[model samples]
Target: MDLLRRRAEAVPRGVATAAPIFADRADNAELHDVEGRRFVDFAGGIAVLNVGHRHPRVIAAVADQMARFTHTAFQVVAYEPYVALAERLNGLAPFSGPAKTIFLTTGAEAVENAVKVARAATGRSAVIAFTGGFHGRTAMTSALTGKVYPYKAAFGPMPPEIYHVPFPAPALGVTVEDSLRALAFLFAADVPANRVAAIIIEPVQGEGGFHVAPFALLRELRALCDRHGILLIADEVQSGFARTGRMFGIEHSGVEPDLVTVAKSLAGGFPLSGLIGRAEIMDRVEPGGLGGTYGGSPIACAAALAVLDVIEEEGLIARADAIGERLSARIADYAASNAMAPIANLRGLGAMVGFDILDAAREAPDGLRARQVCARALNEGLILLNCGVQGETIRILVPLTASDAIIDEGLDMLAAALAE
Candidate 1:
């Protein structure tokens, strides 16, 4: 209550909080509020805590780096951790041939830099994104994002030359064919293929919903980019780092992205984002063209290296699959139950699961009920979140390191919330 009061006075209203509780501490998959109440964390800090809150390995890495040095501003005095981390990411790049990675401070920077790289490589100024896809919060990314209400509302005069086509979501009445046709139309109508720099997409839409991109759509996009000399960028900011069962979500479709924007869980909980691209395209930018003063902090790089180690050593990729199965099964049972509110459209890849709350008639999405479920889940000591075009999706992002018992406990709370 005191913290809420202080926050009301100090913080801007534009920054909304999903829950009013203040975090006192957090463990692998649980958080304790300042009031000393415990809650199961199913949100995973908006897909940024796949390794969970304060993993010992990440903490130790950060502490060790702190003991050595915090920041030298990689641009001023290139550090080893940054280079080593970039090397690891490059080796893990989803595409074939030599790859290169440049670290940045946030997902937006990685995405924005990716556009810059694409334009530099292709000598084109226009970019294409999909409806229901979210790239970032920056001006350029906001223009790239398809959603309107909150992300773009009142933020008038978005940057030009960013086009959006329909994303294939059957529930939304947009089919793969519809999306492809729209793309073709976009090429002919708004911008020509030759003038387009790149087409950026999330292999699995995050803020739009946990809808997995159809492999057919990806294949078509790849072919289109190939024929037109446009780059294909995979924005893995929310779907990367083992949250999608694979190391990178785009790997699921066997469609290699020319450039991948990665953030969120890249450094466990640290603020570290990176853009990995084919070596030739990456080198298109001159020496002084890329980099930020705090682009690759030594502490974040150390944490990211440790995060990579944790993902490999802990078998988190496989763990993500198991967690997804458990969540899907439970949600499937909920859909069958008349005791719960109408729920439909359970979808996701790996553990990045989402289901929509629907009207009692099952004819339409029920954003109100979805919000109520989240509210009830919070009251029941479970931290949950909603997404999708209509805000009717309940996305489950519990940590991969979470124990089965913790996962089940969170699900039980979720069930109770749905019943209410």
Candidate 2:
């Protein structure tokens, strides 16, 4: 703790703060703090380690690649792993038709490149995004993000021609029709539909309280985009890779996006992300228009390939559904017994579960209490995270690799925190 406070905590206020558990080592679904305390990691590095921390396969693959080569700058001297990884992602994307993929180092990079591809393909400038959507923190993604605090605060003068409309949140009383109406209004009032290059959304919003975009709305967006030549981009940075019981979150709805941005859990713990889309759309960008020095580092690619193998061999998609049901049931049970601050608006798909924190005094949504619950859970040996625009919602993002015992243990800590 002292080392962290001195070295890390003092570094930057811009860095997000969490409980003072300095992870010394991690394995499977458990993390050992620097103080040697064991904690069940429900947070999963904010949903980055879906295969769990330091899985032997990922570790071994990364190690093997490191021994052969680390960075050759795929553009300068191409590598087989990069090509192989792209091939795998191209097939894994939600589209049954032919797709292409471009790798990058972070979720933000994937989002930025996706927009670039959209603009290049459509030859348009305006991009439509939904309220409570979180794409990334790049200049363009920050513009795409709807929530103002933290993600957008102090990051002034965002990109131009990006527009935001209300996304449906039934729990908050915003219906799918309301959201579509707002989009129509946006086209009339701001950027017209033809002028819009892309309409991006998170199928199940991550920072925006895990609200699943209705299938009806997604179908509507696809129709609208098709009518106006606007591309649909799914920002699956936080919800992709079996987190939602499918390879991609957009799979929840049968609607296909023109381009999809994926990251977080793509490479287990490695820094890797990608923009996947129709082959023609992806080919619009010039050879040098996309890619970075470490865009598809060989080691990261190897690790990502290993992650895919793990997901398939372990049948994590099925596990995600079962875990989500169990977690949702437990949360519902807790809410039923505790009438003082009943959990309202329980929502999510697969293992990505979330519920509201009602006010202790008035039984209304309480953001502070949710933060308190997270803090208490951390102290009681469970890693947790809070989301939602108002931060009044607690989300459970435990790894699909987690065992039933670990899930139960984490839920026990949550129940104890609520009881307190």
Best by lDDT: 1
Q: What is residue 71's positional error in candidate 1, in angstroms?
A: 0.8
Worst window of 10 by summed lDDT in candidate 1: 70-79
Off by over 4 Å in 1: none
Give the per-residue lDDT digits (tens) of candidate 2, residues 205-317.
99999999999999999999899999999999999999999989999899999899988999999999989999999999987998898898899999999999999999999
Itemize residue pairs with steric clashes in candidate 1: none
RMSD of each: 0.7, 1.2
Q: How high is the CA lDDT of each candidate model?
A: 0.95, 0.90
After the best TM-score superposition of candidate 2, give how far the Cα of residue 11 lies from its true spot, in angstroms.
Answer: 0.7
Off-target runs (Cα >4 Å) in candidate 2 are: 8-10, 339-341, 361-363
Query: What lDDT score goes with residue 184 in model 1?
Result: 87
Displacement of residue 385 (Cα, Å) in model 2 is: 0.3
